[model samples]
Target: MWTTLFLSYSPIPEYEYVENSIPTFVAIGGFPFIAFHYPSPPMGSDVVSQSMWPLFYLNEFFWLIIGTILTKLLPQKIKNYSQIRLFCIVMTLIISLSGLGYLVLRFD
Candidate 1:
């Protein structure tokens, strides 16, 4: 949720056209997935071409709902299994490390 909020507010330049073309602002939500582009109008132009990616928001909402449902429905025995806990921890570490690596490479 915090990531989504931050990404929505802080868009990074992802692509640029020719010298005269407008630059595209891209924001990635939901961690490493779901990116949307916001195109701004060129200077001194009244016409604005902007769009919102509903799926970007929808995807997060969908996951939230699904996660809530699964948490409520799944048995405690399965949720509390040692192997499951270990797998979740490992996966979280891998994802975090990969994301950190990407950020370091990108910003460096």
Candidate 2:
């Protein structure tokens, strides 16, 4: 995830030039998820800066690890494995719903 994020920020002049214009959501999909639901449309920089960004990155890192381990380390017979899979599915649904809610609720 970090690699992808960093690569996304790679010092390509075109990327930088493109990043300079448009709403934050136009630069990346994530903000649109929030701004779409937010009561007020998002303004200002869309770039994820600040110490919290590392935390967000780390959170995604851990989720990736968890997903990998769940798929690779678990045996098929474990009853809880099904539950875990369900939980993951539910998590994806909930996240998408939230994004959709953001999009639907925002005035824009």
Candidate 3:
């Protein structure tokens, strides 16, 4: 899930430049799933600095692996994943509703 460099920055923030993606949702696991396109890529020399990124799909992939292992290890505690799945579905619905509103209001 990606967009065509659709967002602007806070140095001159505006309403129309907002962009989002699902990898962000899986990565961050919260409200306001923003798509962050840096003006330039982080160099290898800046190791610590790179970790501060708002978006990290690689992190999300590893997290998913860990989460799956954990879920398997704690199936009974999580109610066989049903409860968590329900919660995620509900949150997705809420976010989608808000995003629809955002697009409607953002565009003419």
Full-model lDDT for every candidate: 0.50, 0.44, 0.40
User: How good is model 1 by TM-score?
Assistant: 0.37
* Candidate 3 segments exceeding 4 Å error: 1-77
| Model 2 agreement with the true structure over 1-108: per-residue lDDT tens digits | 333332232222345445446433333322111111112145533333453345445646675887798879766676677788899799888876774454343325
Q: 31-88 in candidate 3: lDDT tens per residue?
A: 1233332222222222223433454454345546766898788637544578879888
Q: Which parts of model 2 have CA positions greater than 4 angstroms off?
A: 1-79
Which pairs of residues collide in model 3?
7-17
> Per-residue alpha-carbon lDDT of model 1 for 1-108, expressed as tens digits?
334534554465544345665554333334434443333423323322233336545656776787799899976666558888899799878866775454333223
Top candidate by TM-score:
1
Off by over 4 Å in 1: 1-69, 75-80
Q: In what order do the candidates fall by TM-score, top score first? A: 1, 3, 2
All candidates' TM-scores?
0.37, 0.30, 0.31
> RMSD of each candidate?
9.8, 11.6, 13.8
Model 3 has an lDDT value of: 0.40
